[model samples]
Target chain A: MISPELQAHLQSVIPSSSRAALRTSVLPALLTGVARVASTLRAAQHVSLAGTANAFGDDQLNVDVAAEKDIRAALAACGTVVTASSEEDPVEKPVVHQDGITKGESQETYTLAFDPLDGSSIIAPNWSVGAIFGVWDGESALHQDPKTRQVVSILGVFGPRTTAIVAVRTDDAPPACFEVGFGDQGKQTWELMRAHVQLSRPPFKARYFAPANLRSAGEDARYMALVTHYISERYNLRYSGGLVPDVAHALTKGHGVYVNPVTAGSRAKLRKLYELFPVALVVECAGGRAVDPATGEDLLARPLEEWDERAGLVCGTAEEVDLVKEKLLG
Target chain B: MISPELQAHLQSVIPSSSRAALRTSVLPALLTGVARVASTLRAAQHVSLAGTANAFGDDQLNVDVAAEKDIRAALAACGTVVTASSEEDPVEKPVVHQDGITKGESQETYTLAFDPLDGSSIIAPNWSVGAIFGVWDGESALHQDPKTRQVVSILGVFGPRTTAIVAVRTDDAPPACFEVGFGDQGKQTWELMRAHVQLSRPPFKARYFAPANLRSAGEDARYMALVTHYISERYNLRYSGGLVPDVAHALTKGHGVYVNPVTAGSRAKLRKLYELFPVALVVECAGGRAVDPATGEDLLARPLEEWDERAGLVCGTAEEVDLVKEKLLG
Candidate 1:
């Protein structure tokens, strides 16, 4: 009747032995962390700034710091996370618990990398912003290439209505997507929005998003030309200056493309591990494609060799991503 | 202490005799209609459309037809409206009430014009869409020149959080804006987010929205050139293909511009009565400016002489509007 809940779906995909482990331990902690962060962001009008710049040279709004702390505290309470890192932190740190700090001792130990509050810049203007997280089971090497310890789970939380897009993969299966929202009873409930939602790119309208401030002088002129061409072809422009919602729109609508490409005019903006890996995995699992411009290969083909290196990403239906390769990157 | 409620603000600006009339009659009915429509639209996922086409030749989703019915039904119960019209309906029609079908006889009778679901096309994709309404007290003639019966009250309802923006004016005073949302006990309550908010143009980072798909061979080349110039100036594009939320973002952010212009390539797209008049009035009241291209004057300088005439609008800080006039329209 309710279809399989996200937790139930996670259980169904895993070996029976580890099903309870995920259902009772790791997923609950991750969900709790997201909910707490969502509650904090709901009252964003009152959030203050810490007056410090984040690792990315973006000012760390006070809300970002608070959300990170809240997520960390929530995860620590669940006692399943061995390590955690965020865009605000310089390096991965052990999750300290009441019993003791986790040193990656247990086989069930999990690691989390997150952007506690993505798109913080647009919060004051009542724009939709989100929190994104990626989780790995068993801490192999906290900062290794994403391929080395590929994330088993990914989460995107859009603040309004506390809506969540959660996807989980097990063993060697494609990721299964589920949605969570507050029910009429004011309780958090999950529903399966898509089992394997795929993209169909034919008859593409050229809807896309590029960062507003592209370098005035650079190889980006080709990218600009592609945008102009798309406009001339009558593609509707639907960018919101937010990654989570923009990507979600593409998925929900089942078409269109989103790119963060490297050019002479602008360095690739999305980072491989913190941002693109989880997003790319979700898009690919949903029957879409995610490509890296540098190698002209699938973005998920390998673990990111450089943690801080800029990564170009093109994602959508196979046709759309292919067109980006041919028209924009070729 | 809480700032004055929208109703109280409305009372302060009007004569004592008419203040109660507006407070007890017209405003409540308008607010109720908006709330009913907003509640209906919040779950746009479930709305069943009649599968008809609206007057604009755009396909009408079932939600549009349903919202129009809901709003009309709510208004019919209030017994204060003399005439009403909606975008889904082909023409302005008299409101037949429970007491009896009375023409525009009493001075207290008001006329309502609304777009029951603006930007309904984007609803399926989870984009923010809104309901807009404008009220004119004492309907001299329905669907006449927009200049003849200027709207005294305008409402924009963003369905996500049941947020309503109400602007009211009386006795030739500048309009006051207030925000309404559901409070404890699920009762609608009002808060003043901006008391006489004004736009200050400086250090402009271009954040703007102009609908894509401009007629390819139309006289709009100069407008396109101005957009290119803005991009060169590093203005950020933030269009959601929805007008109410797009314009609301510009107001709430206190910066940015929103334009719906007519060029040789295309006629004015927004309707003078249902869309532009209310939006232009709100933008102007909020310390911003709204201009009509054909007349090269303030949008509200006079009533639109034709109900069905296409109208071009440019709204933002005075400086930005002036720049638009000088650069594109010049």
Candidate 2:
């Protein structure tokens, strides 16, 4: 549960721009809804109970449906949202506004696409996993199918005109802060944080925790244990077992690192990373950092017109993030 | 293919001592037989294709059979054999002179127990793997089975007086020399090796390759690639993909490092590191080193009686091994 002080801080940090309003007001609720749907999907598959479960197969479809519904509902709640389309249903058609919600006339517009889960296949072997996304404005859907989505356009969003954001969760402590970055500026932010923080110190051990599944409580527990053990042995770092949860936790914690390094073959496995940004500007104002590792630039700095081609991200205190960038991109 | 010069060098370098004769006359045949049996088992599984076979499973059984047959045959050929017992069929009672194949008057006696395929399960994942063995001068196998077999008084060989040798094979280069260590003078040998090698170079890269199966030729290729990449990138080092192959290669090459870090669970995983003396000896002999990271002591110097309870090993050119030992054990 989020402390009242932290919740207020989150609410106060939201930007006043049109993008920020939608992100601050509607993104969290949408993510919560998506999490619920994902949970339902896992329950249906009996993955949350005792028995061997194939983590892939139909569970993927369930995540897709849940992601679509959450994004649509969130968009509908924001009057400025003009016809939202996602990679899941890429017809450029307006989202079905359920609950009789109507969109208000506003120049502000955006499109979102995502992989609700990444590295899901590794769940059986208990490897790291997470979610990913790509977002843009003036476009309803980026690709015809989620399977065909490209990260190149996502990279485009890092250009001077665009804004991008990502939220992560794991099974550590909760009410975490989300990281935000824009263009090359993100790299500077990361470096600053690194210089200020002694990365090798205790409670700041370098650990990675990517949960493959988010819905099943049982799997969640296992994911938590894995993360806890890894962190406890090293630096006492914690995660929330979900992309948003983990990202949020990182933002609030002020130390540690979060990454979503998806190789080419694993793009479609997760989507939360892709969706949270367009609607969650609160992460930015909370003194956190996030950016795509490939460009060593901010995730939110690029315009929505070009956000499909970008690689995955690293989000944390500036210094730790810079270390990753140096290792991967530098 | 081994160059003629290298082959000649190997043949000449092998000691002419009774034990050296045993290794020269027995180890190669055992390795060859194990290879053949492994191939046959792979064929049985219909996994003989170039790229699709698993290398660790039932192939282990075949390797064991082949190794046992070759070792026994070699001992018998030397005319210093009375009876033999193997770890696999310990209850069969020592095979007495029969069918005129063996001279009943020959009082020479030796016993051998082997894990023909160590880390065999790593074959499926295309990782490094190998074989190990212990030789004793008695009639029975080292560890007895729970179920009583047809023969009872087969002369059990107990305690640390027995000599042990391990043969490792990896996919890097040809098999080199064996690591030889004696129970009484373990630490002395370790220190000599530590004084000779250079270990500190930055940008060090470490990789673990444990294949799940070993019978598939295709799996061998993958294992080879991993070994080559890791060694080349880290230290321009090369090792055989199997235990004997690796130990032999390291012994002669006189560079690089070999380590088996403790995994999350399962103490049984450390057996291969515990059993080999010559591998450590050769590593030290060639200006390299070997130590158990958990204990910070030279593995060869440690008493074998206490090895079953130890964790894992870290070995390399003396300097590198020492660095790891200092970080982990210190």
Candidate 3:
């Protein structure tokens, strides 16, 4: 059953000034792309062979590469998107129009930045993985700045129930949060499960994530001790080697912490534009906080000099994230 | 697509001597029940309310209790199952037939022991949880001896795809393994994906699971040290708070190890008949080993005297499990 409020969410992502015009635009195409990609990923169990190393130097499962192609095809066929940027592609790829408009000539309304298939390395284990995309309103033919320009951010988790969590920030309104159950195969059909949901405050249990082993080589002892401290405090370890599902888990539960810390001699693990920024916006929109451990500022406020620039992520319930900033990083 | 071999596996679980009779009888009903139950669980993301505590004293998600009812209703409709047993129920519940078979009058062919919603705790977090069942060929009514009297064991993982991993031992031949994509929702629609798959040997990278916090109080220092040693050795950690998916990962990857060890106060974490025996049968069928870490005996060989009898599980690649026995327990 697609929730009625989910359509409201899809509609809200567009600026109210252009609501009617954009209503039949990029959102429908984006949702279609996500659903198709999810449907394609369902075949991962049948395809077990690890294909090759991805652009990020992680082992790309055959399913991952296929999912990227499926999403790209779905998005391009939408005709509203001008260009697609992904961690899988070294350079931004132009989406061909069904009409005879060339890439350089056709006026497009939106540019998409996405991680077509997140956490490809863990596909073999059958762990939950997801696809994430952010949409920027096309003022220019291409959005020169991605981090500050995105009008909508989405995290899609293709787990037991395929879900799309959307954060829509129109210039007039504070960002709104909604979760839509996609993959049920209804065009423009979405049921909104929650509205104006925010992370729960203190006295809730905390769950956290650290992608790489803190005790692994070159990781600082102090960082390891901090994680050990979190463990000692009875924080549940919630890392699934997938950012989309982990963040979605936090969003739904309304509590728990998730972190990808920068270690000594290494930059932060997740890409700023493709992953961290979009998720940070969602977290912030939900009244939760995403912060950089180094400067102790909101991750959303940080400048992204490069699309691949990375940042340490500490995000979750307002209190838990506050606790992390105050007690550990302080 | 449901693998063709998977259908053969469902049929093969019935003893060849009575193959035709049994195939037309209870097994199809049972598979239908499992598939329906899995399909029901696919909606868990929408049904996020926490339910009453389960028999294990763990917090039960609403889906957990509902899943038990869904499976029970499906099985009862089949007319072949006499009684359904699960961790959720305080005692074995007799299946109520649509034709109104009284508890005493109806002669049932199979007694099922199951964890209807294994890893129920992980459901809220949207992590992979599973449905596990062991079928006992009924000579009498409800089978009192659970450990030894099982003819078939099936593990269903509800991840991106709803997969049923089956191991059928018909006395004369070695147990056979097959994976069926049951959620595709069509009868006799499964296509064969794999046959006689085996666990990879020592040179294969290892993934391990120990559900408890290694740094927690009452956990033995020796065990902690051993797990830390394994981590240093670069073994991937694969615990998702779900046994079926974790073990399924080992079977599919053809390598890795999973253990629910006996902590200081705890006897062992996993229940004998419900989880350990069914999984052990599947692992051993795949040429891996599932052992009682104490006496160095196979878990399937041990008698389960009580419904909640706990046993330490150490199962994976033969060489890797052997390493656990030699280096840690021994």
Candidate 4:
């Protein structure tokens, strides 16, 4: 788990430019901090494992529990959260102690529905996987039905002001830091990366890393190494293997590009994130970018949810993300 | 160019199995023979120190001219051809001699269209590529406009049949062979090749030589080396970049798999080949199998042209091709 001080530091870094000032608010920034910390912890655990089986159902539950606890604590500290509803808690199957010492009942204003480990199937094969969440204001209806409750939160969160972020944090830090540019600047960056390698002729080759089990530190390190190799501007090669942890490694390391191309089959999840300013704010704070490739517009500025929605995405950098969108939409 | 004797040797060595006899005929076999020779000659010319470029607009044109010349010469000698249409003269373009000599003109009865190079772009990127063709009976209604005339011969001979071939020639010759397994077998072959340094790994990967270019002794040698590295049972790798040249390479070497994933887009080409017996017959005679992955059915029964048709294909050894179909279709 990330220390509270570090979480506070992360919150402070939310970009203040633009209407993002809303995202920089104490509430959203705190949520972003909590989410980042959860991801970091999950990544550490995944790297310690050897194979993908280590990341199945129960394993996923454990990671989600840890993340939920951290997030809840963070929000509680701020006192902005009047009540919280989590997918992790069972509505009917309440916890009971043999000693008749029951734990506190569920209490929260906002509800959260999350898939803590999406694309987990790719773990054994070294593919990308990620965490996804939807948040809605506490007063939304459907808070009565357990099954329908998760859907309601997701639908409620689908609108402009919603944010999505994918981070690629790596263990290896380069000697010098660089920023990725958009549009023409982005193309120039690619050319520059290629040129630098061609001139130096470093014995570099593109590599892929996908950590399946974030509970294992060993697997996490391996995944981190792979991201480092891919994002090194000198090498100019990056890989996501289809998961958030793998992508996050690349973003945090500030090396290569990280992209998630929206597919026609998976737009529901993207729409759900547009209702809140948390995820997008955190990603931008980390010096990355997120958007829906189909529109080439700020994803947060669009409707949060639509039945005909196509796809949603987030990337480590704006340029890299845009390139992926161009390929898919073109 | 392969001598007439060598061509005869190749034709005689082809199997006469029931499956082989049912799928192809004399005309297509002769065309295949001509194609082999033309490809060899082109490869040889390219490799020679006195490199020369033919006036043809593309590799496809070059192959057409070479194949037509060989086929005409052979047919004239054997008195087997009553009439034929070369792709270069689809409308039987009048051959006019400008010299001060007596003028003569002849009309062609049979129409042919040939794509001597398919997936040619693969070569530049060091990927696989091949050739294609379609042949039909010339008895169809003729159009006054040359461009409007239906080239039945070319249209009839396109698709998967152009890709299959028998592994063995005659008792005295070696057999053509290819594998059926999926990525596992491919990876194993890749590993073996890399371990022996017989084939270089990617980043500075091996070059892709067009079959036409591979015909030259030097280019042929390099191509053979690559083929040997791939087809060795211990390696268990089959290479089928596309039709025509790829199949020809397998036919020449006596072994290699031909893979055509049943994608949603390739139905039209498959249907056209069903009209002509040449492409299908040649592959069967050469000792290979042709199969549709969707139904695990023999693909040589007929051609499929509908845009919505869906099926994958693998043409080579019966056992190997079947295995591939199972893996992909499943």
Candidate 5:
């Protein structure tokens, strides 16, 4: 059910060896699975509870559980995913073989880590939420540099419209990003919204900022100064309390910087493999930068080892990211 | 075309004298028109512009212009809307009569003021944006107490779902809020999602904060203290750079406070007619409080005589708003 354009796209950016598997099962399963998450959220929002809290984060709202189940099921059915992890489960699990038709362990085989639902804390308010996926070319997500092994990153945004920003990498060409949308009456079809998406490009002076962990400002004076600097210089504020939407805003504007600085008082909470890696890959592929705020090194340079590995991030348009590192990290 | 439940709702909240008009024209036109805004935004997000700033603001994106035309046209066709205004075109203008049948200049003849597309600055990133409308029962939105004259307030949220938080105030009963979704294969019909929506109620300590104009903290010490207090107390952050979504989040969470303070250094930018008043009515109806950040008076108590009346607002759960006032204003 994929369009020819998307078909051609997967062929070019994904390694030639993995193209058939991607076309046959991987991408279809991924997109369709995320679409189901959208429907589940829409349906969940409808069930009203008067005098009840409007939020879903504290106890893993049913929507979170449903998103994991739906996306996990979609991937497991592909039979190409040999191993997978989720923000919810975290433990690497062998996706149960359902169809009994499994692919041999090869470079074409994939490993995945996903935050089935990100920013659930804000969902009760019906603010936008998202799902993050990082896909590796081989069976395990460990002991490998994501810059070379991680082939795909997809961020599915749950907002007024259901959309996903897909980033792909190939040794042959510069990594690129694409925007796809879920629509059509049945809410099942995935249509290409834009191809070759990129962050705000050259001659770019910083324009927008998504500053997370503002609470850290109270703990760290430099953090507070950084916040003031942005205002004094007049950078547009776009913090949405969600990693995917915040970075996605930069990917959408092709300009902007996102900084989640780690202070001794406010340790960084974004998990590397599930949360940060996928988003970092996507932003980098879109002609932006993603780095550890502490060292300002490439975020992808780090291997996925610890299941709960967390890091502070400064990512987005390369120039703005540089400014963030100089002002805060330096 | 209206559902029995909605029809019944209108019959009760709207005066008996205006019931037939609301049922026949007002609500239908308003809902359908906002649905069009959702569609326009979705469509606009698709027309990708690479290498361009990922934003539709500054000079007014095409989406903003298109939204005003669509909603204004829909309202004008009802022939019952005598005067209308928009954040885009702030001057009050007569919605030219489109239909031959016009309602008499009675209480049923409505007045509307809308921010056709609120938070357009953030829309470029595919983040959620919204429409805010205040509907009065008579010809002018001026010289009237929005607490009473503003009979209906609709907050249209454009996100993974196209939904609205509608608040109605009637002399006969307590004000109440409702949530509705736009769906079905056609994206034309409105279905009840939840009824009698309210903010988090009794024994509630605030859980969320939408801090707008945080840049003001640089200018005012109290503003900085307020941000620190919220952080120290660990108020969940729910800001999305949009007034409607920020306030809607509070309404949905059933508990939260949103504060946009005006310091000697930073003047208020939210207009009374298009943004503040409508949201105030809805929050109040939902058992929340919306007050001027400085004076701590009922926002609706002020008359809407000025077209561009800007006010600093502290709204949401009553107790949290009080905390904000005490910490900063006092």
Candidate 6:
């Protein structure tokens, strides 16, 4: 049950030139589709350890494969999406026009990069798992600058509630980030929960820290130093092994830093195109900073890696990211 | 929709002597009551900040107060609970018998202590929160060691799924801990998801860390050393700021250690009667260890604190808990 209220919100946030097509056709199709996926993921209790390995060495859980297949099938059903690529299957695949006979007025096509299950390593815990999707205009997401072309970021959280931290970015207006919930369990209805979302930084009580890849501290002195700094600073610790929840925690708390540094010895484990891009889009839209840990360059501004490239990221409150960059990279 | 399957399970695990009464009357009513409460909590999107402060001087949220009230009302309505205590309002309150005309045959009266909302500090983030309850057969919890007196522990988790880690500790037979789910959202049904839950420790690949109260590390060198040890040992990190989820994660994931130490400079913040006792019951029932971080005493062996006495706890996989105790308490 997609809400008319959210449809109205899409109208206000999207540029007026494409309002008619996007509001009525494109975004609604995607929102409803993702909501359904979130619902399906929520109802599941996934624990099977015997599943085929993906292109990566990580063994794909049954739920991971199912999520990817579900997202692909969902995107295909929408017909508005031009292309999609997922973490389990990173190759870009095209979406067909399923609503051929019922097609409406012309609208910009969307190329989506998604991690159907962002935190499979942490999934078995029956803790909170999530789905991350990045929406861009045109046929491909290969070299596009995420900041300009990335139209939306849908972060589906499978926590107590099937909630999402969604962002709508338009060239004319500022990017909008809101928290929305899928209606009652087993129901398809969607409701707009928080109208606006922002990150809490210094001088605010919402301060916390999510230190990912702590193993890297053994190899990188700077990573160790930064962690020591956070401890000494008394940053409340909140590092769930899952990526979506870690970043989303900072956003919902309106404070904190999700810092995963990739030093030479550490090497990167999180794929840039699927995991980082979508998360960074959502973070930046929430008035936070999503930057490369080493150079502090805006991650969305950097050209995405071609095939399953992994890297480090610093995202959350703008000030905290800056502090991480200064201390971690130095 | 309470499944006949779980009710059947209740009968099998509960001691045969009290089986009929507990299965037919007391436990069912309590389980149903908690299921409804979990459902109500899952549906809510709590962010209200204005509320009264609890005895601990921490600002309580409206949701916190409401949860306490709801649990009290539910317990009163159940009519089998003779006495109860709560974290928000730590006083022991007597529950009035409501089923006078419909009262069943002889059954044991139960006493309960609960932290209705355990992770309110992390609630603003829209992250996972939980409910912890400890049940005793006798009238009072004062001076009694939780291990023998604590008959059951209901660890209600408000995650994507309305779930619980329920432990029924019986002296006559082996204690049983199982994971159960509340039926679909908006439905009052219940389902048993997992029959057995055990923790993963040294020999398992599911090792993880949930470092609560890292603020104490600045004042305590032992804690800082423990953190460094975890990083170097490459334990996967998973410390959400919520206790219910953190402890529940260990039970669900079959691994992980949630260590919070109270030092000379860093005072304890978790209440022993409600928070630690309830959580310890669940952890121990899952074959894990729950202990005082300082003396390494079995936490369940300690007597209940009359008021909301705060202390440190180290809980989870047996090997991990022992490792934490040696490293952090040394």
Per-candidate TM vs. native?
A: 0.83, 0.35, 0.85, 0.28, 0.86, 0.93
Q: Where is model 4 more than 4 Å wrong at Cα? A: A1-330, B1-113, B123-240, B252-255, B264-271, B274-279, B303-312
Best by DockQ: 6
For model 1, how does the per-residue alpha-carbon lDDT over B149-228 read when each residue is reduced to its tens digit?
Answer: 55454555442334556666555555655555433114445444445545666875545544433433134677667666
Clashes of each: 15, 106, 11, 78, 12, 11
Q: What is the lDDT of residue B6 in candidate 1?
A: 54
lDDT of candidate 4 over B113-143, digit per residue (tens): 3433343322211122333343333332222
What is the C-alpha lDDT profile of model 5 across B235-283, one tens digit per residue?
A: 6666788988888877776888889988897788888998898899888
Candidates 2 and 6 compared by lDDT, better number:
6
In model 2, state the lDDT of residue A51. 32
Model 5 lDDT per residue over A1-330, tens place: 566676677666665664567656777788887887877776664533233222222356677778888898788678777788888777777777676657543446888888888986667667788999988877788888888998888999887677899987866556878988777434345677778788866665547788888777777777778877887676767788889999888887778888899998877788899888999889888888999988889899979776678899999888888888888867
> Over the stretch A152-174, how does candidate 6's per-residue lDDT look in tens digits?
88888876666788888877777
lDDT of 1 by residue, A1-330 (tens): 132464456666554564355556666676677666655554343435789988778788888898888878877765657777777874677777755645433346677777777776556554556677777666533445554355454555442234556666656554565555432213345455455455765665455543333333123676667666666665656776677767777776778777666766566777666677777767766778888866668876675454475577778778777877887658
Residue A94 alpha-carbon offset, candidate 5, angstroms: 4.5
Comparison by TM-score, 2 against 6, better one:
6
**TM-score of A-chain in each prediction?**
0.86, 0.49, 0.85, 0.41, 0.91, 0.92
- DockQ for all models, in order? 0.28, 0.01, 0.38, 0.01, 0.44, 0.56
Q: What are the Cα lDDT values of the candidates?
A: 0.63, 0.36, 0.66, 0.32, 0.78, 0.75
Interface RMSD of the candidates, in order: 4.2, 27.1, 3.0, 25.3, 2.6, 2.0
Best-fitting candidate, measured by TM-score?
A: 6
TM-score of candidate 6 to 2 decimals: 0.93
Q: What's the C-alpha lDDT at position A144 in model 5?
A: 86
> lDDT per residue, candidate 2, B137-186, as tens digits?
43443342201110111010100111122322222223233322111111
DockQ of 6: 0.56
Candidate with better lDDT, 3 vs 6: 6
